[model samples]
Target: MSETRIVGLRTERGWTQERLAEVSGVTVRTVQRLEAGNDVSLDTLSRLAGALEVPLRDLVAERAERDDTGNAGSTDDIDDTGGPAAGDDAAARHFADAARSAWRDIALGVALLVTSPAPVVLLIAGADAGLVPTSVEVAIAIGLGALLAIALVATLHLVRASGRLSPFLPIRQERVRFGARALRWAERLEGVHRRQRTRATAVACAMWVSSPLPLIVVALIEPGRGQGLWIAAATAVLLVVVAAGAFTALRTAWAPYVQAKLAPAVEARATV
Candidate 1:
């Protein structure tokens, strides 16, 4: 069957290939192939029809009618209003979800990293105070270490998963070479254009560098006679700076993907 009908129907409904694949429980690559006019099984067609909320016969019939009418045009054409195509909007929504998911994963990983050391510290303190038996403490320490290792691995996985969605986000190249390499690999997997990757890398580096400035300023400031007050002030500043930096990083990483998907609409508005 001709794929134009499927493409046309999907676009008309403002659905991206990714969105269709998700709703249809099919792989994105498979959707891409099917839309490229590759032959697919009836089961695949049925799934797609269900996802599109159309009957299988209607899909086939639409294609036949379009072929007979010879009114088919390129999907890239803008509408009469000069706005973005529905497919563009669909893409924007899909990537926006990915961006949100990536940030959430990052946040969860950070939380894991911050808490993973607590159990070890607690166990050591308990043993010193004779609250924990020496033998039991040793076993607990070993188990805690293993748990920490597992948490670290899970955190790294989440970070890598986020990198796949937001290839522009810095994965701490200086501190984590493996993570930086993973980010690069993810960028390639996501088919990020070379130009976009270069631009994103530059922006990410700038953001990462600037993010620490506030904390540095706090550190450099001379603490007056009240050492406790100074420490509290510095801690508060560090917390605020870290929170703001994380927020900025998330926004910066997500912006390009969102903008790329929305560019047509933005350009249309500008021309109008």
Candidate 2:
């Protein structure tokens, strides 16, 4: 009922929510809400306390604050001053940034699954032959499903790698206007705008480059005397264009030309 226990325990140990979450097997979001005394589940509190290297009873203990009746209010009602020591705003920010990156990863992964040659091919090809899947159509469906599975795993893992040490390293912005908030509201909002543009632009651009996938697939599926060579040649050209775009995405130079979008499929992972 009171976060004073959580706060007092955290302050005593000097652990950030991120650190706490790491040890607890609980998500940063859950740790955050618990620290606010939001009536979280017992399992969640057990994890949070474990992450803080404290007992659940210790985390639930009352702090110095007390009402006239000698009863303490809900910990969520406490001021920031009563929170973690050093008030580690940077730690809070990092948690938020990590969350933002996670959601972004999911968005991009979904987009990749949608845009990947496999699924796009099935949707475009299958709809034409009607929903009744044939043997060959079923095979195509299986491949498409596999693409989505791979994309999902990549997105989920890369979500953990958005820190300064992350591969898709963030630009240093100590004084930048855009930043994560303790509440994470602004982060989610901004991430949404960026993701929407990222998908729209990547799809529009990929559309131009993806024209050859079907052609290449056709050539491979029904290789004739020289069809494969023709398809391969066209694929090579598309690859060149894609490579250039990829470089631009890496350099963030494409941030403008593609309506301020990075490549949807490529992920930057943090080594840590």
The number of the candidate with the highest lDDT is: 1
Candidate 2: tens digits of C-alpha lDDT, residues 31-131: 78877767665335434543554543444456434543468554432233322211123433443444454545444444443334444344434444454
Give the per-residue Cα lDDT of candidate 2 at 166: 29
Clashes of 2: 7
Off by over 4 Å in 1: 1-87, 135-140, 143-153, 156-160, 163-272
Candidate 1 local lDDT, 1-272, one digit each (tens) = 66888898899989999998887767999889998977665446545765776644555664455655776433222232323222223333344556656655665565455445445544554555555567545947664886679587757858655544432221111101122233333345345544544565566456556645654665677865544334444444444444444443444345454444344334434454
* lDDT assessment of candidate 1: 0.52
For each candidate, give its TM-score against the true structure.
0.37, 0.33
